[model samples]
Target: MVGREGVAVAKWLNSLGFYAFVLVHRFPNSETGAQAPLDDGRRALKIMAESGLAPKGISICGLSSGGHLGAALLSEYPQVWTSPDPEMPQIEFAILGYGPISTNAAGRTIIENKPPLPPKEKQELYDVVQPDVQLRSPAPPVFIVYSNNDPVVPVTNAYRLAEGFTKSGAPVELHIFADAPHGFALDSPKELPVSKWPVMCEAWLKQNNWIE
Candidate 1:
């Protein structure tokens, strides 16, 4: 279910004079496997590039599982992420909101109820696609946001990703909001400081020259 928050974020970006594309995909279950979502994300990027909307570059912004897919696209497919068809625009930056970048760690918690895979297979799966494991040097700039009070995905996932990006010498900005629950999105309580994430994000984007 795409919430009003998602639409609000898109509209906010549009107001900032940025073209926003929201890509939605079916949940990756035991039958579909994890690769399906990644493929879907790639197809969306391809379509956007071919559409001629973003010629210089594109910035991806994702929340929750969407964030995970964005990270996978950037990390696992470095060749495509870094150097796509000359006709296609490259991914200049990414904004991730409460993403579980480490599949293994998240599997133990968020995906524990899903179909079970053997230890070796799980490890192999993580090695191939987990954003934290797949992170490399010269990656595109990343902006990560998470809340310490999140009850679903652990806050550590965000820290781990930020650490990995820093270790790889990739430009990264991290924001840890206190007392906000998971899935807050743009609907976070007005009383909470976390509700200002969108404003902070805009500042960050402008500072990085992402917005012209």
Candidate 2:
């Protein structure tokens, strides 16, 4: 789902002179489970650390499901998700675009409706991946963007995440567009104010010193 958008963002970031990497992971199918993407993300970070690309802390940016994955990486996770290497680079900040932070709310519907898994099984999966339940204090700063008209992921997800960050004393910035639909990405029409999200995100990154 995110492949094209991810590559586009990576190219744009690279044009701005930032070293960007797009980590691809397999999607869930009849033969595979859904947890592989999150594991892939952790391994990607570890690889970046090993490659010496991020001597300083690293920042993450994600769209849609990728955004959900980013939230998991930032929030507290079970020991199974923890890095074995103690010297792993810290996450300085995160940018999430239409991420579904509350897995119980967003996930329950999908799991119950799409999969054949029982309620008990769905609950267990939600326990492992839900960002809202896993949020911890002193988390890295976050910038979130969403559209009220988004039919895919509700704007409430943005509000919940921003609220979590505020309560945890982590810096947060949120922008809610009035009319853009879900998965607008960087292709938002010029007339729609949501098209300016990229500029706003870049400004946020500069203000936080994540970008020069």
lDDT of 2: 0.74
Residues 17-101 of candidate 2: C-alpha lDDT, one tens digit per residue: 6889987875543343445566577778888877887777677888887888788777665555454443435778888888766
How far residue 198's Cα lies from its native spot in candidate 2, in Å, is 0.6
Q: Where in model 2 is the C-alpha error above 4 Å?
A: 29-32, 79-88, 103-127
Query: Residue by residue across 56-136, what tens digits does model 1's lDDT show?
Result: 677788887677777876764543223333232467888888876774543444444544445443433444577876764
In candidate 1 the C-alpha lDDT for residue 104 amounts to 51
Clashing pairs in 1: none
Instruction: List the global CA lDDT of all models.
Output: 0.72, 0.74
Error of 1 at 10 (Å): 1.7
lDDT of 2 at 102: 65
Off by over 4 Å in 1: 77-89, 103-128
Using all chains and alpha carbons, the TM-scores for the candidates as numbered come to 0.81, 0.83
